[model samples]
Target: MPRAILHLLPLLMLACALPAQARTMSAKIARVTTPVATLEGVEVRLDWPADAATGELRLRAARVDAPDLGYRFRALEWRCPLARDGQGGWRCDGELHADGGKPFRLSIALATGSTDAALSQGKASLALHRSAATPDDTILDLTRVPFAWAQALSAQAWSDGRLTAGTLDGRLAVRTPEQRPLRVDGTLVLADGGLETPDGSIAAAQLGGRFHIDYRKPAGSTLLSLDGELRGGQFLYGTTYVVLPGRPLPFALDAIGRDGQGWMLPSIQWRDGAALQAQGSVAFAPDASLQDVDIDLRSHDLSALGARYLSGWLGIAGLPDLEASGALDARVRLAGGGLSSVDARLHDVAIDAPGKGLAFTGLDGDLRLSGGAPVDSELRWRSGALQGITFGAATLPWRSADGTLRARAPVSVSMLGGQVRFDDLVVQPPAGGNGLRIGFGLALQGLQLGELSQTLGGPAFRGTLDGSIPAARYADDRLDFDGGLSMQVFDGSVDVTALSMERPFGVAPTLSADFALHGLDLMAITEVFDFGSISGRLDGRIDGLRLVDWSPETFDAELHTEPRRGVRQRISQRAVQNISSVGDASFVGSLQARLIGLFDDFGYARIGISCRLSNQVCVMGGLRNPDGNRAGGGFTIVEGAGIPRLDVVGFNRNVDWPTLVERLAAVGSGDVKPVFE
Candidate 1:
């Protein structure tokens, strides 16, 4: 609109040359051209009665196009009464309409040496001024103007962005000279501004800022520089979401680019006092993907850092509720769209993830990583916890290079009345289409089992726990421990083998292992479980055990008395009754059922039970009869060996696993009662 009005200045000057005797004049031009714009089908008319003091003027154009500015208009018309000012100038005021859009007021004042024009609609207005003293310079003043008015200008640089809402108020100086590039420099205030790309990957809203912008177009290339303070707003780019504080943040950027060639940022800076400070440079590909980046960041108040700058990334990484505190400084560099190097310094940092059972405190370190050169660093943490198990301080010496991180020294932490040590730990971060990979050697020494049980809320069995994992590797969300872990408890050794876990930190974690118990003291085991007293040595094996989400799924297990020389094998009446109730067995003895109530205990030659569990059912088995034959299609659970001895047999072979578990739980809670019959 302003361009159309400016082009009429020359025509208006020619009107001043008309003879005073001339009553009317008209002219038509097929096309008129200017450096920035072109007009077609232009017509001008003026009428003045010889006695009148002013002339009536009309201007019309079929189309106006400014390709460089992305502006096009059709059917533009304006009519106004032109009068000479007392100071040797001309003034015209009239209504202007274009492209069947709303009509607006266009006022032009032409002086002998200067020209000024204004286009106003309702509460918004834009005014332009140019002087003969500086023919190449034009000054524009804007008041409550919609940002959409500059959509064409914005498209010249950011073709994928659409300005959805905003308002601008400020002054700008535009320079257009025949021998120089076009330039626009200005200070502007923006309010309630919004812009977004078609894919919604880049978006901002409610943005308010005061900025100084300088933009230049040199032939086929463009350059821009901006310095400003953003008051408050939210914006998202790719996976990064930033929520600005209420206090202003000072920032600056300089960029250069050409059409379809993407952009290169030479410098960028941001300062938010102690909360954050950042300086960086970036490059984007033609498709708007990141090509390279180098940034340095520092934060003195890490308590506010997560919410302000880390929430979006953390949420995407599956730790939405993570919290952190303390100070940090870091530098990162990327080349060819991949990480090339990183350096981080931490001071007294603490991180916690509630409900996930992982936390760390008092962390201090400097870690440096490079894909080319080796870097040495050390990290120390005062305390940490995993799955409710807390561990004391530890320090790790690290060397990172060639995309692998290796521990230079063994790491040891005291926990559960003992110490755990890791040797030869190596880590490879996710890259090249693979997940994280870690390999380490683990050793446990003199850990108290009773304390561990108490901490884990399990049965109170007393002894020492020790194990050595010669090799343990984690990859693809699964962890495998080679070699076995052994526990000394109940005067026996329990060994676990083939231990592996899948999705250890993900949904529905699973564990599978096999266990073997040798020569365990039944008396102590029964006392720990609060089951009826049993006196003998026991042996057991649980093979192919599987658990999902910490719940038992399937297993093949067997427990039996081991006949050690000089060992008394006796089963109390209560123990016998509890076993009968759990296994759905019946007693068979020489004495009558009534007489069985009188005995306080019974002697057993042997006792054994086996269960192969699958699909929520337990297939029960017991010791074979004397002749290695079935006794009335039943299995003997116990064989008598003394006077008034008793035997127990199980008739039911297939028992619901849950029901069996309920019966065992009842026995443990002392809710099951002995039945005489």
Candidate 2:
């Protein structure tokens, strides 16, 4: 049924019981005048049989137009027969409005100064009474009123949106005093259906809640205090999602609606969730535009905030694998349409990202941030582990202003039996330009390389990693480190420089660097890998090295050994066989082919090899000895230095890089077999 009719029913009833004038005696008609609405084409019949004691009433209306309530109706008719009692009182019985195949019955009793009226349709009913002290005021009482009826009358209140499905049960007391003001006290219960806004500003699913409302027309530009609680449901406002498990999120608010100006909420308080609370004021323009807002939001549990309210945001921060637990108190103030201030303190916080192998324990700190004010924070990391490296407790003091955070002093932390320090560090938040930006200095002191290798399940070597990075910067998802880091292992120094990375913590990241290997003991390296030993001082360099997704992409590399003054350089027979199979080469120079297998090892003057890889092909090279360029101009990878000595020569110059890699893998796994070449 069109609830528009219900909105107009009060006026229709008034037209029936009241007459315009009794001067004419035979009959009189009065047109109802109301600022709430204008009734057009209305006719009322009043008959005064005894001129002053008895009367009958009838009413008819072609249409009613109420702009204030957004109601319009047509073809309205009601008839009631009025009878006078002995005490100058009157009563009427009537049937009105056959809509949706149901007729409404009305009963009214009126005296000179007071009136009581009842209207009933099906199982729903409404009552109205006028106080003797103020005949211009109407008190409305409703019981079990159908929500269908309310919807038809409240179209404008929802911004043209409708309550598509739901069951509502409530009782309300309302008073309207002529044109002075309106007041209401009510309790409303909503069932498990949902509501949607046309503009998507508010929407919900499986919604169930109870609300208590106390309302009064604004005195000035001012409010109606509304209080409510959400018991259960999944709610969506704009784009925020909250899964409510029958929790009470209580709120109180005051809003004033001015005729042409719009609505203003001057005071508001809401327990945002189990862990957060917010206090704010909002003003919306007549067109529903958010004209202004001021809010102070607080949270006491950082753990719950991430899992409950911050999942989506944290995914973009390289912490997608987050599981956190901690006590943290934070205050965020929003004003002037931006985040103006933030103050947070963390206590005994524990955070972990298992996928990234990162964890922090006993983290505590106070961080202060405000517009036009410098920020200061001192965070203490008690103990933790990350990617197999354990860290000893340390305190990092930081300061910032102008959108960049900087370290007030160098911070040192023990790791891998040594210390790592960060100096002159500066960082920008995620909201800054290019996602996030950072610049820093890094220094490593006496880090044990053997422990690191053992922890990584790699070849164990005894040495130390000691280095310094003068500067490093990250922006636009790329990180560039200037200077070099050197590790002394395998009796050698491995120096890396020109190091840089893109998307270091993101998908398919790339790393580029150049490295030089000096004074490496081939014997110790071969012993660690269980490869046949070659006793010599090894030197090598790989330039323009690049890896994409941790797989080698390109490089220019060379490895060679020059004999020490008093050291013997010998290649084991097994090593010779592995190299022959891997390089797809043959023996050359002074060794007897059949007798070469008789010896377990052979002396060599020098050994060298090179691969300039590009476009997935390796241009291989060997030693620069004059004898290396023979009749066919091939270089010798292993030079003979004794009678019946063995020399290994590589003939394939343009080997496929992937094929070479596979062959090397086979050699390392002891699966190589010599291929005649």
Candidate 3:
């Protein structure tokens, strides 16, 4: 048996033990009343002399209905001292219990000018007074009720989630003169309340609030005026998280709801560290879905707007790391459940971050916006920086309407060994349930590749990168470049096209592109790589190349020597040995093998390589047998073409990418020296 059951067994046995010959009587009860609930089908037992004015009463009921609260109790029990009042009345002091919890101390009096009751547990209590009037004229007072009890009373009020704990102190007046829509005038103070939804999208660790609410209903319409002060708590609503203050965040609203018209709020005012004012109305469908919304709002501080309300919004927008301050005044209007327009201005603003994500200093701007139309604005910044790229004072004349913000003309920034120019740039903020959009034409001029490589901590290739993007756009958290980017390297041009990116600022960013290398001077490439000497021109291409989290994952690549009339196609002995190591192959020369190192260089008719990588393996291939499978079988990587004829055959058709990377690293770091076979 379970240990908990064993512990409770003794208690159960003691409760069931009844004294022999004890006075016990059972009565089928049709109804009984309490301040909170009414019981039916009850059985009662009295252990006392007949006709006695006082007795020990034991009452039990299987169920109780609390119509006022829309709740039903499965088990109800009462044990009390029953006494007869001198004036044709009865009073009882008892312990009332339901659902196996610690009983509450209850005092009930009947016919004492109607009825009086006080039900209490711990520090909370429910005090009630009921007037013994006709059904239509009766009235029940339920003002000093515990929040927990009220929650249990109306369990069906909200089916999606439940209120866990709270203390409520309030005053309510209920009148039932003649079948009218029950009106409630009350003030409720809620403290230490916690609520969580089933899906966890909306939750609060602890919530505290004080509100004065007036509720009325007439002709299928419900109207309310609520004024409240929100106190300290940690709250999460969808992707937004906010920590409220322990003191007061005052707010007021007047709203009304009609059966078919949904709900509307005409006036709202919120005052926290700052003021946020809004005039709005919204409609919801029968099943509680938004039907329509119209609102106009104003703010004085952008940073405060985020800190107090949309705390998680900026973070999700890739601007989490920010320190912003200064005067911000903005007006926003929404209609049809969408952002309709915005007119804003900022003065003397400064923002920065230790993460270097983004920073701006001395910012002044004006923004005019119209939903799905064009807007006009101007912005000027004293200095700004992003990813270590610094810019001096600059101004941008922009137009924002049509769901997008675009610069009136091209804007350029000089940074990090390059000049970045933006033409026809348009930026669309993520709003109205849409992702951010940025479309522009980009030109990068004279970007020093070595400096860029150092900045990105990549290979140090010496060159000038000059490229233009005819059209580039970003949407749905992804960015794509339409044209190609080219860089001068090894006396040749390296061109990149079909470039795209996914989740640029999110987890596991992915990038894809294609590259073509043409007229690469092998001698210059070998010199930069410290891979001995080679005199030839090379051509290569990488198609369908992809990188996940900055790691190569897929590519179809090939590199080969391009033969030219009168051009020297020679490979140094050291270069040959390194290539052999890289390919995991051996040199096969038709010359004296023992004297292979005697020659400083050897001529090669052709040199080729290919790798079709997939599943972490590079399916390696050498020069193809363009002429009848090259005499017998296998590839001819290096065809001998001189007195000291030599050739290197790549024996392994499948090489692990990691092994290849390691070999390259070893060669680059001078760890792998040339060795004769």
The C-alpha RMSD of each candidate to the native structure, in angstroms, is 5.4, 7.9, 7.4
Name the lDDT value of residue 225 in candidate 1.
97
- Candidate 1 residue-wise lDDT at 433: 60
The per-residue C-alpha lDDT of model 2 at residue 565 equals 87
C-alpha lDDT score of every prediction, in listed order: 0.86, 0.71, 0.70
lDDT of 1 by residue, 198-234 (tens): 9999989888899999999888888999999998888
Which pairs clash in the backbone of model 2?
Answer: none
Q: Enumerate clash totals for all models, in the order shown.
A: 0, 0, 3
Q: Assess candidate 3 and give its lDDT.
A: 0.70
Query: How does candidate 2 fare on TM-score?
Result: 0.69
- The TM-scores of all predictions, comma-separated, are 0.78, 0.69, 0.78
For candidate 3, write residues 1-677 as lDDT tens digits: 00111111111122223232355544556666543346667666666556555666676767666454446665667787767677766666778776887777776666635655667767666665555564222223343345556554323333455666667787655443444664556778887777777788767767788898776655566777889898988787777887786888888888776655556677766666543555556555443444455555655555665566665776775556556777666666656655677777887888776454468888898977678777789988888876565656777888877656879988877765678888998888767678788899999898787776766666677888898999999999799999899989878999999999987766577999999999898998898788889898999899999999879999999888889777799998888888888987666653536667789898888888899999999988877667313433445567767777888777777889999999999988878866666
- Per-residue lDDT of 577-630 in model 2, one digit per residue for the tens? 877776766887433467776888888889898888889898888887687755
Model 2 misplaced regions, further than 4 Å: 1-5, 8-207, 213-226, 232-242, 251-303, 402-404, 430-434, 506-510, 537-569, 580-596, 603-677
> Largest lDDT belongs to which candidate?
1
